[model samples]
Target: MTFNLNIYETMALVSLILYLGKFLRSKSSFLTKYCIPPSVVGGFVFALFMLAIEMTGVATINLDITLQSIFMTTFFTSIGFTASLKILKQGGFKVVIFLGLAALLVALQNTVGVSLASVFSLNPLLGLCTGSIPMVGGHGTAGSFGPMLEEIGVVGATTVSIASATFGLIMGSIIGGLVARLLIHGKKLTTVHDESSKMPPTQVGDYNEENHNILSLKCLINAACLLFIAMGIGSIVSDFIQLTGLTFPSYIGAMIVAAVMRNLYDFTNKAFVEKEIETLGSLSLSFFLTMALMSLKLWQLFDLALPLLVMLMAQVILVGLFTYIIVFSVMGKNYEAAVFASATCGFGMGATPNAIANMDELTNRYGFVPTPYFVVPLVGCLFIDFVNSFIITLFINFIS
Candidate 1:
């Protein structure tokens, strides 16, 4: 028998799963120590349950994941909102250097993945599924490109890509903080102030309910308005760009629009609450990740698990060496480099949230360094996708 879930029902279940994951994280010391997102924990559990049932040939499920793209786009758009030209300028050479480093990593990941896959006698194109397509591109990119690969005769491409992303998410979260920890302590790096200060002001703000409740509401609404406008205009831009025969993710246009909006808002000296928008972005990311994990078709990945693990391990090793030898050195070999090293692991294998989580955890332990807080997100969250898309395309054509 087949069970189908509508979009609303899927959303309801996702929300519940998120809550359950949060509860479990609070109860589990291991989860807390690793800084695992509740959505990942909860969604993985559901996926495993589904896999068990499917393997038993008892039942199957079809989930409506339409909202997943919407949430993904929304989350990325919020990242764009943080892309103020002023901040980028203030970020100085470190931001430019790090962004260049991140872009180079995309090509490197594909090279390593494809090279090893050839050594393993696997299809070279299949390696892309395991490479930056999922590693740097995250689950969304994995899902988007999976079927295209399958159509070109790469078997189980979607499954391989998704599984790689899932593994990346967990491994990224686990090791990112550890990398930063080792670098910070080993190098005797120091923080200038409390790490919490690196967070958006609203996150740390204490407001009297009577005086600030209305203000808070207004801020949220304004953020929503700005996000909606960016998304709306972004869709049009994405469609127009597609007409030119060069494809991009829907979120790319939204991100560009948001960046422009942010710079404009900053230039005009407009009053806007960046913290509230960041909060909204965080919310969207949680929901999007939960939905992505919940929708995984685990049965599709069974045969490829061994190869996936081998390639992913290789990817991890490369990431570690690159961060330590390259990212740390280029970012100045200071306290912020340690933090950026952690962030590298996040988006290098996982996504922006993982990178942020990695940085947040390390900062909490060693104090906050603002450079990583600014540079990592701008590079990983905003710029990397554009560069990654181009590199992935180049690899596809090269291998094909």
Candidate 2:
């Protein structure tokens, strides 16, 4: 009844509740099926409950902003860790092609955003930001960078970015799946082979079980400390940018610095706990996404529902068309590569896990991965973000 309990208290409560629920099998069939990431679902659902309480004059929206920031920071720190250069090396030129296709989609996404904004007589510059990057880029990307857009006079920019990212996630999921299906139907799919053509196999059962690897508490702590350091460095770069009369999103620099640190550790073979890295990262993303979605101000969405729906529809159509026509053709119509490429754009232009899940759901049904699992995440989480930022910036400037 009392809402004054701090985050640690809240986290303990949440963990206990979840554990109890799991013990009771209290989760919904839909939830279990989607395996909805708790972060996104939990955060979102909790936020809405807060909103509902506010509407009923029972509570205020003091969203423990500090706690929110920490959760977001952890989520992105995981992102930076997962962005290791080692992934690209493992993935090889498949990584290169994924980046290339993502580059093009970033350009196309802005074109869609700006052009659509122009039709509605809104500021085209703001339109570009609210499109896929911030919207699809998730809360860290949106929250960190959204304020800058507001400072530059983009009204309701935060809301717009959140909405767009949510829409992007949905679109990415659908398009990624659709693209994979089409690819499999059109041609024989191939596994992505590295130069090592003789890639070593992990011990048997290391497949999805890789997601369950345990690591030392010390390593987790070390990784957390490194992420905090990255956040500090991100603040420095962000501050410098603000002073220089140039702008970028808030979390971008932090992610970049953290990514650089992650890569350095990986390259130097400086030991860091990375065994369960991918799984933790994926789980973090899923939860973050679920939380973000559950918190949706359903009312805010009600009025703009028409516009939001239009934007959502247009985004879906555009992403699909591009996936089928442009991406497939450019990637030499290699089914696996096309599937991966479309997913990169789908998520970059859309949602992270949506992109990955899109690929996975299709692969599972077909009984084969059209592309390497590592390929989509490598580009979506790490490489494509930088390119999308550059491309989105270009759109904003071009319209201005």
- Which lDDT tens digits does candidate 2 get at residues 235-292? 7977887675556556666777877887888879877666545444544544444334
lDDT of 2 at 194: 28
Model 2 lDDT, full chain set: 0.59
Judged by whole-model lDDT over C-alpha atoms, candidate 1 comes out at 0.78
Q: CA lDDT of each candidate?
A: 0.78, 0.59
Per-residue lDDT of 292-364 in model 1, one digit per residue for the tens? 7776777877676777788999899888888887988888788888878888998898887678777767766
For model 1 the TM-score comes to 0.79
Q: For model 1, what is the alpha-carbon lDDT of residue 63?
A: 84
Cα error, residue 282 of model 1, in Å, equals: 2.1
